[model samples]
Target: MKLAVVGGGSTYTPELIDGFARLRDELPLSEIALVDPDERRLGLLAGMATRMLARAGHPARVTTATRAEEGVEGAGAVLLQLRVGGQAARDVDETLPLECGCVGQETTGAGGLAKALRTVPLVLDIAETVRRLAPDAWIVDFTNPVGIVTKALLDAGHRAIGLCNVAIGFQRRFAAALGVAPERVSLGHVGLNHLTWERAVYLDGEDVLPGVLADHAEEIAADLSMPGWLLRRLGSVPSYYLRYFYLHDAVVEEQRTKPSRAAEVAAMESALLEMYGDPSVDTKPELLEKRGGAFYSEAAVALVASLVGDRGDVQVVNARNGGTLPFLDDDAVIEVPARVDARGATPLPVDPVEPLYRGLIAHVSAYESLALDAAIQGGEERVRDALLAHPLIGQAGPADELARRLVDANRSFLPWAVSR
Candidate 1:
């Protein structure tokens, strides 16, 4: 009946609150505790959430906490959406890897590994507190690098499931293109977090991907930044993040000339916080859509509803492999459709992955394993090894250089690097 949001001060909070308000019948809550370290932001969000709930005639009480232990206590579910170093650090994560001629994005390549090192430890620490304070609560992680973060929680024996909006975003898009209700479109989403593909689009259990692609290949390809012919050739739709790997050189060049995604988000957050301070603003603003995380709240609400109510429904989530993909280690966290319920997420059986996607998934899975090592047991060598293992930075020369830059840029967040 009680739910807690670990990074409730984030500008993303209102979008979540809007979902809670609209979907009350699915997941009824008696209270919501917004947990954050920044009191000013937390206060602003709390007021906004209160107004939204009141306007919706939803009875859930909104509360604020400056500590994880305080907010998560006695809650049925805790959602982790924190940024360990905030946007300033994200700016570094986005731009620092360009020096090595690598894709300088937040959730992949050298930048993703850097974020893992800074984030995993703090998330695990919060999970421990959740263990002590709310032993039965489920921790739903919506953090970047969901695969790595969820794996750390699971490996440490926490009850957690990783959630992302990518699948829902695709489902919604496909449904719109087909002029059908969103629920009627089921995606055969496969691979690891951020690295995934939609192999099939099922309408009423029929594979209609070919038809959808035939009609809107160019439009879909445009959204993913890939060529329309490529979609027809591959017989599947790769997630947008795949562009980083598929068009690495071009992306690197563009990243060199363009402002980082972090900078854009930082500016958006500033405006959103100011908007939240207004008492008259009771609803989520249109500007929030451009802030990204499209359909995030819906995905979160559905997952939480299924878990809390034990619906035993299949939904896409970042869950343990458990032999669903024979090529991957059972403990590897993968983004795929899974049956979610009281026991947590169990990935569904996947059809044979094409060698192209399978090899990359296995490769990234290995890098993620090493990235976790570097995250849990911090050291420059672990960091370098993880970078070397990444498909994007396979060469030792760039890996070594990126690892050094990563640590130097994130020393304040990575305690082990402070001595250097």
Candidate 2:
């Protein structure tokens, strides 16, 4: 089978290519089309991918294409991993929100809305191309603001599944702490992308979450930057991104004192690219671990394998709500454990959520709906309204200011804003 990676130039591609090689048995790929607009970066990554695959004795042909149309053609799966305005734009997204006294994040607050506005339209356009070139292909989105992007694709009637590494990362971590193989761990992970919680951890069909917390609360809390008491009190582990909500003011203070994550990632990308160009580097570098997206390759490969091979196995993925959560609309995209097969991902049944978690999830889900509307039908008011709805930017004053700054800073990316 053939697979196409839309943002093949990204530093994350090598890690993905490594997974394609290591897990060749799980998902046998005959060809990989690396699609990117930057020919220089594309060439560097293609060479790296070819070498890595060859070293693994996998006979997959690596091809390069500058156009999404050309790259996705005849592929069984199209992986969308592109960044619309690149890290330069992400730097602005991360910093611009701090001006409004909000958390400066790329995927959850005012910054996340800015990214959604710029990304959703572009992703939809690509989905259109995928429809024309590879109609039956499953579009596995690993893009930021995945919940919003996946909603757009599903809204446009595309066969798509949103994939994130958060669930897989948690599974791997929990398995290590419990001294079990990664596959032996299953998470009762639920909520939106980047905004999820590990409600339960099952090993051999038994929930050992209480034992995990009892034994490893301090270490787990340290990783999430949350107090161990909070995990114990809630009887669940919140994703690290929840820190933005749980300790908003504290996080803002810390963000102000440090360089934006975009800056760090930018520098890391430079070093990673330099390493990618070296012929001797046939394997993924250790530095890639610090670059984040931990275990992304495993997650992506497994999801694609399940989808292509008609393996009706359960995996955590972002899929339509379909009444899985009684409060959310059927069309709302939710991140949860789902059964995957050739038909697509179907969210598994979830137990009733506590009011504490449900309230926050509902609030964010509402904001996401408005954000999607603003992304699809661009206007200053829609942007302002979406910002106002966000729990991080609930006040109208900052919301209005953020709306103006977001549009102005991202005018080049938002065509409607550009025309205005």
Clashes of 2: 0
TM-score of each: 0.99, 0.99
In the range 272-347, model 2's lDDT, one tens digit per residue, is 9999999999999999999998899999999999999999999999999999999988999999999999999999
Q: Which ten residues in a row have the lowest lDDT in candidate 2?
A: 411-420
The 10-residue segment of model 1 with minimum total lDDT is 411-420
lDDT (Cα, tens digit) per residue for candidate 1, span 1-420: 999999999999999999999999999999999999999999999999999999999999999999997899999999999998999888998898898899988889999998999999999999999999999999999998999999999999999999999999999999999999998889999999999999999998999999988999999999999999988998999999999998999999998999999999999999999999999999999999999988999999999999988999999999999999999998999999999999998888899999989999999999999999999999989999999999999999999898888888888898888887
Question: By TM-score, how accurate is candidate 1?
Answer: 0.99
Provide the lDDT at 123 for model 2.
Answer: 92
- In model 2, how large is the Cα lDDT of residue 408? 95
